[model samples]
Target: MDGIVVFGAGGRAGRAVTAEALRRGYGVTAVVRDPERYAELAAEGVSVVRGDVTDAGSVREVAGGAVGAVHAVSPFSGPEQGFASLDPDFFVKAADALLAGLASAGVRRLIAVGLFADLLGANGRPVMDDPAAFPPEIRPFALAHTAGLRRLREAGEGAVDWLMLTPGGGLEPDAPRTGRHRFGGERVPEGAPGLSYAELAVAVLDEIGTPSRHRTRVSVFVPREARVRRT
Candidate 1:
């Protein structure tokens, strides 16, 4: 078994995760729709594979023979009607397609990137549990995240080992990797200093070799004072 497969390796956080994993001496297979777009990734020792996340064969070709997989892939475009329009089935469609491939290829461990919306509030209840919790402009995306979480949970079904790394509400792609971090079980406190993509990449690479944190949702945060905050 080599290193993990990085799905959606061309995205902001995805690229960071892949690069950090490579730096840590892990063999990386960068799965992307445009493999050529990541010629630099190949130049850096990643095996680039082009595939559709929603297609099972396409996924297995990339995920096979791996100890673990980092599922950073997402489909930003899909079609559905009504509230279902807000359904995260597009994510599920892609993930389920990948999961089947992973199962067949005997790749069990999985680290998935989920949204902060899936996390609980100060009261220890999921924010999505209250329809009024989020603003109208964001509810659709939040609900979509909830849907994706549900899909991942159902896919686990006590058969597969997996973890969902949920970012805090304020997470962004700014800042550099300080290698500073704290871990939260299922519900990291809301409004905490959120993580930067670079730091998140560092954390993911660290967690990969140590699977003690298996099947858990780890929330990320930066210590206060490292960055500016807004009201």
Candidate 2:
């Protein structure tokens, strides 16, 4: 209620965001498909609940009274997972649900994590358009993500204000938090380094607390200079 509700709390980014929120003393409503699976996420200031990101009723029910909400849901985790069951409209459905549900629940701020493949390359084409840059097999997921972004744009800045933070490079799951990141425009930052989940969480919470950007997607990554220098 007083804090933020994270939709995919069981996943890597969700867990990182939850931890970062807790570290910052913000109460968290960690939403997962199965609460029992994320029992470890429940703590003094954290509430683990079962919710579906694609279902407006579920989003409304779980997001009630929250200051902000996060959309970190991903239907496909990796190449090993395959795209056989991946829904092309997964993100579109999520965007619709979050917009309608959060508005109904009175939550005004929404932060949705984005896929990098949709970012433009130097050649003025989406990174996904170049097989050498992004795997062609993953194009469906990229297109789905782009469609969701489009849906959000079409909705405009009505009741719910949303921002999508796309990682410019890979996400190093085990990397440490440097508490530093940079925001870029439509094109991926030239030499931006990969961001750790912790760093990404920091950016997410920062925006929630201060909210510099609005109703637009931005690229987030560690500056090459911000990378930890090895001895």
Per-model RMSD to reference = 4.4, 1.8
Top-TM-score structure, candidate number: 2
Candidate 2, residues 1-231, lDDT tens digits: the string is: 368999998898999898888888888999999888776787455899999999999999999988989998899888888899999999999999999999999999999999999999989999999999999998999999999999999997689999999998999987768877889999988974689988899999999999999999999998888778321
Considering only N, C-alpha and C atoms within 3 Å, which residue pairs clash in candidate 2? Answer: none
Residue range 191-219, candidate 1, lDDT tens digits? 55677877788777767777667666778
TM-scores of the candidates are 0.81, 0.96
Candidate 2 wrongly placed segments (more than 4 Å): 43-45, 229-231
Candidate 1: where is the Cα deviation over 4 Å? Answer: 77-87, 123-135, 156-159, 188-190, 225-231
Return the lDDT, model 1, position 213.
73
Total backbone collisions for each predicted model: 0, 0
Query: All models: lDDT?
Result: 0.72, 0.90
